[model samples]
Target: MLFLRSRVEYTKEQLFKIEQLRQLVQKSSELDVGTDDTFLTKFLHYTHWDSVKAYQAIHAYYDFKHKHPTWMAQHPIEYYRKLFYATHCRFVMPRTDKNGRVLVIFKTVDAFQQFPDYLQGLIEMDDLIFESLLMLPRVQQNGITVICDLQGTTRNFLRQFSPQFMKVVNDKNGVLPFTQRIVHIIQRGFLMHVTSSLFLPFMNKEFKERIFTHDGKHLSKLREMVGYESLPAEYGGPADNVLDTNLIFNHLSQSADYLEKLQHYKKRIV
Candidate 1:
């Protein structure tokens, strides 16, 4: 068995395999993945520092990205904001979970008015999130907390889970940076249909355990896991909720200037 080299013990063969796997990826469509030191290190940790598993994980990641390029493409700022203001999705400010892992929140409502064709947009945003998530500093070794809020939503989110997409989700999800520490699902009683239809088949035993279902009355627990103030008003948190689309759009436009400078700096270190 292979182990993450520096943290644990590893064989020479494992070391060779790491390089071999790196070469394999360099030749693949996702030429940049599985080759960077950060990714190599992160994948190792994800697999208990096992080199072979790390190699396989890296390959799966690149393969998934190539196979489903649209799965996680970054869209324009206005496009993303529309999805957020439409009441279908939102990515609150990044923070850490109880375990210090990066916490990512995704809030969705019943039907997205005007933009009824939410599958493509929601799916795009989901992919964009995971991609952007990789750039986080805490993302390398620290894990992730994916919160799915379906308190007031319909099961429409599951409409995209065809056999093809299911395979894509399952294959790539396993190798994503850090283990999925917990997938906190709010309003499980009313939304189990959504979870069962879309998520259950993609989950393994370990993944299923990481997923915790909560009733509507469990905001305290939600708050405890992910601090209440960080959540938006819709989630019963103190943060500013997008009250109007025009204002939200203006906010995004303003944000682009700041983000350009911020992302420029972010590139050097993260």
Candidate 2:
């Protein structure tokens, strides 16, 4: 099993790979650009929206910029500016451990919110509105692990950052509205686990442990204070209804899968 520490390290390696790929993509001809799409398509076969592909895509674009500094300088200000905005848009952090593995961390809806005000002010001073918008705040896990947060509208943001990886469940084909609701419910369940189990635990351990270790008397008392008869299903508490049970199970399964994959990735890096 891989420790949380090593996972962070692996993420750095992945980031490096992404940067290299981006450079290669940038220099290649327009026809060659499709290669990245092909690569992404292959990557998408297994992964979902929050997969490695998104990380790789953003890095690839960064590499392109590095190789085409002069092109950016020569193009019309407005044209180049828009291109720059489109390509250099997402924010990603490199979370790594001693042995260099990626750590699982929060996926901020808007990474720019994580940036320091000073840095943001500098970007604004340069009149780099586009770049400024891309700045994101990130917290390193254990003060070493890197975390990535993407900015912009969620759909457009994901498309730019990880085009192939983000799942497109709803296309032109109309599905029942309830299906969308179900999907959201499932996604929410997974998010709750990430927030409560992964992020919240790091924030406060004693408080969390207290909830878990409490006897029925304390648990009941706490529940009353919180206004719930029992713990929510995402936290592994008993379900009050069939829908709750299904949602809880779905969340538990997703969390288990995510943790397992993270462990697997960490082992490879270690």
Among the numbered candidates, top TM-score falls to 1
lDDT of 2 by residue, 170-215 (tens): 1111111111110001123333333323322232333233222222
Clashes of each: 3, 28
**Per-residue lDDT for 1-270 in model 1, tens only?**
001123434467646655765666565553443354544555665776566677677666655555565655345665677566656355534335556665566666655456776666777656555544443335555667777776545546556567777776676667566644577887656455465557667777777777876676657777777666555455566656432334324434554443332221211111
Worst 10 residues of 2 by lDDT: 176-185
Name model 1 segments beyond 4 Å from true: 1-34, 74-79, 110-113, 155-168, 188-198, 224-270
Model 2, TM vs. native: 0.18
Cα lDDT of all candidates, in order?
A: 0.57, 0.27
What are the per-model C-alpha RMSD values against the true structure?
A: 8.5, 19.3
